[model samples]
Target: MKDKTNEISMKKKIKNKAFSLMAKKGLKDISMREIAEACGVTKPVLYYYFKDKEDLCYSLIVEKSVVSNENLKKFAASGASFEEILVFIFSEYMQDISHKDVFPFVIHVSSYLLSNPDLGKRFEVVKEQNFAVISGILEKEYKKGTITKKGKEMALQLIFANLAHLILNSCEHAIKFSPSYPKDMARAILKAIDYREK
Candidate 1:
């Protein structure tokens, strides 16, 4: 039992340091040795916990990403109206980014993935799992003729990406935007996805 606890603690240390290293230097630029050093562990110990660099990347995506959770799945699968769902999602996202840790962690993982396309394939399963919940909602609307023939990606991109961009832009570039931007973004996504404005 103590061994298991120590293993978990060491893994957290490795993940935390690896995240910082990846955020500082691009993902490919950082090596296992550097991560091991940051954790004050030997190369063999790091290898025992993670198979390789690819395994570490998978760990970061699968184990470290906070985006995948039962709450998010439940929210997406809720019977709320499309507009309500959109507003709720964007508003929650806005609140999430306001936290000191969550937003930056998301940005780090995202930026790393953006640059390293090859590593992204490992994350595809998790992405598909998340998409399934929202896709069901979008498909229901599509079948009801409430939305155009477009699939779920359009709505996902418009809501998540646009809202995230607004927050990130304000934080990094001092780009001026109204505080109501999240609400407006939800509305814009509604329009883009052809959901009738209410």
Candidate 2:
């Protein structure tokens, strides 16, 4: 039992350390040696846990994305109304982007991967899986006549477009050293949801 607990704890520590370093240093600048130093371990140990930097980064991104998707799905599963679902998603996204230091890096890496044919495929797969979670909720809302789109394709596009715009705006503000205005932006997103609002 103690051994299992120690193993779990050590794994968490390594993940946390790697994520911190990735956030501060960016993917291109981060090295296994740096992650090891941050974790108070050595490069060989990191390699033992992860094959390479790309492997570590891919794992981290997928892990975080899946976890976020799970939480969003749980919120959607709560028998909430469409408006409530929209608000919940916006609030949760704002909270995640603002608080998690690694998210900015994750977004950056995703964008980069999406442009390269080799890595783009993997990121795209991960993206589709994550998007399906939100799209599924949107599909339910659309079926209930709560949203404009009646199909998953349209719903997915709109959701992704809105979310991508909001995230990019927030990132730009952060880069400028300006205070985050997620609530204001989130409200704008809420207002833009349907033809009636337009």
Worst 10 residues of 1 by lDDT: 64-73
Question: If scored against the real structure, what TM-score would every candidate get?
Answer: 0.72, 0.78
Q: Which stretches of candidate 1 lie over 4 Å from their true place?
A: 64-69, 95-120, 143-145, 148-157, 160-179, 196-198
lDDT of 1 by residue, 144-195 (tens): 7777766356886665577658558645445755667667876778777767
- The CA lDDT of each predicted structure is 0.70, 0.69
Most accurate candidate by lDDT: 1
List RMSD in Å for every model shown: 3.8, 3.9
Off by over 4 Å in 2: 100-104, 111-116, 148-155, 172-198
What TM-score quantifies how close candidate 1 is to the native fold?
0.72
Clashing residue pairs in candidate 2 (N, C-alpha, C atoms within 3 angstroms): none
Cα lDDT tens digits, model 2, 1-198, are 998898778777988887877777777778888888888988887887899887888887788788888887888788765555666666666666675573577665765576667976766778888777877876666666655763445546655776676567666455432233344443454456542321
